[model samples]
Target: MTQSTIAAPGRAGSRGRSLIGLAAFVILVDVASATASSVTLPQIDGWYAGLEKPWFNPPDWLFGPVWTVLYGMMAVAGWLVWRDRGLAGARGPLLLFGLQLGLNILWSLIFFGMQQPGLAFAEISALWIAVAATMVAFWRVRPLAGWLFVPYLLWVSYAAVLNASVWLLNA
Candidate 1:
């Protein structure tokens, strides 16, 4: 067999390994954001428990499971985009994903950590826009990836209204 033909399988194997590594990297980033946001958990029973939440506010226990699923979906969405088009090829979408992720973490910090619902409402508003932009960008790259973000977008849309209500009630 020619040298080029002999190297084909090896290249394919190497590519597969690289893709796995990228998936791991993407998951790790999401995990890090989750961890950072978890820092406010201790405050929930204290500050958050005292807040005048709207009737629509979900039980505190529900948020953990819901966020876990959302974060998983986000990681997969990002990985799918990267897998379909490598980092360089999908830079714009990836950047949008990263921006929304950062904003996601910041919302937790501002709302729960600092106990500032008003400021968090503003931040989450920006986050809502970012998520929408990211979803559209991801759709352009991979339709499935974009679809994965739909639940997240809906959740955040609800959260934004919840935030506004909380701010208004408490203000």
Candidate 2:
């Protein structure tokens, strides 16, 4: 085989390793956010019950697993884009990704820690917008990366509607 072709796998492997590093960074950020924004069970239960949740809203039991999966997918999607495009190539998407993730954690803090679903609703609106922008940017570089975020976007959209409903009902 030619030198060029032989070098391809090495290049790809290097890209994969870099993607894994990016994924690790994203995971660490997520874990730190979760820890910083955490509310205990009693606190969550009290705040949640006080809110006027919509009948269509999922039960409390659903959030943990759903968010876990979504978070995993989110990391994978970001990694894919980073792999294909690298940091410089995917700067736009990466920025949007970080912005949305920040908003995501802030929503938990507002709703649970601060006991303010109303403000959480507003924050989540920005999160949704950021997610959309991120998806668009990812699409330009890695379509699969953008696609991987679809489930996360859909779930967040549903949660946004639920947040609005709770805020309105309790108002």
Candidate 3:
């Protein structure tokens, strides 16, 4: 084989590794956000335990597992879109994703950290719209990537309702 031929496989391998690294980096951001949000879990336990939740309020244990799955899916969805479009190509959708994720982190801080369910409800309302917009943008770029966001959207919808309920109950 010519030198160029020999170099082709090496290049492909490097690209594959780069993509994997990028995916990992995306997942790491989610994990870090989750970890930071979890810092209030202990205090949240005490506060939440005292609250008069609505009849539909889920058990506290359910959130951890549910969010773990959702975050995993979120990272994969964003990574898929990023892989397809790169940063420059997919700037809008990815920006929406980041905004929603930021809102997600903020919700935890507001409800759990600051113990303000009412404000968290308002923030989550915006987050719900941002998630939908991100999903639509992802759909336009890559259908599968958009489909991956379905569960996340559904959960956030449910969470939004829950947040509203909590706000109302405590108000």
Highest lDDT model number:
1
Q: 70-161 in candidate 2: lDDT tens per residue? A: 88878878877766665666677888888888778777777777878788898889989988888888878789888988998899899899
Question: Per-residue lDDT for 54-122 in model 3, tens only?
Answer: 898888888878877778777877777766666666789989988888878888888888889888888
Off by over 4 Å in 1: 1-15
What is candidate 1's lDDT per residue for 11-127, written digit by digit as tens?
333566456756775676667566656866888789878889899999989987888788888888887776666666678998998899888888988998888999999999999
Best by the TM-score measure: 1
Clashing pairs in 2: none
TM-score for all predictions?
Answer: 0.86, 0.84, 0.84
Q: Residue 102 CA error for candidate 1 (Å)?
A: 0.5
Model 1 TM-score relative to the real fold:
0.86
Please, what is the whole-model Cα lDDT of each candidate in the order they appear? 0.82, 0.76, 0.78
Clashing pairs in 3: none
Q: How many steric clashes between backbone atoms does each model show?
A: 0, 0, 0
Question: What TM-score quantifies how close candidate 2 is to the native fold?
Answer: 0.84
Error of 1 at 129 (Å): 0.7
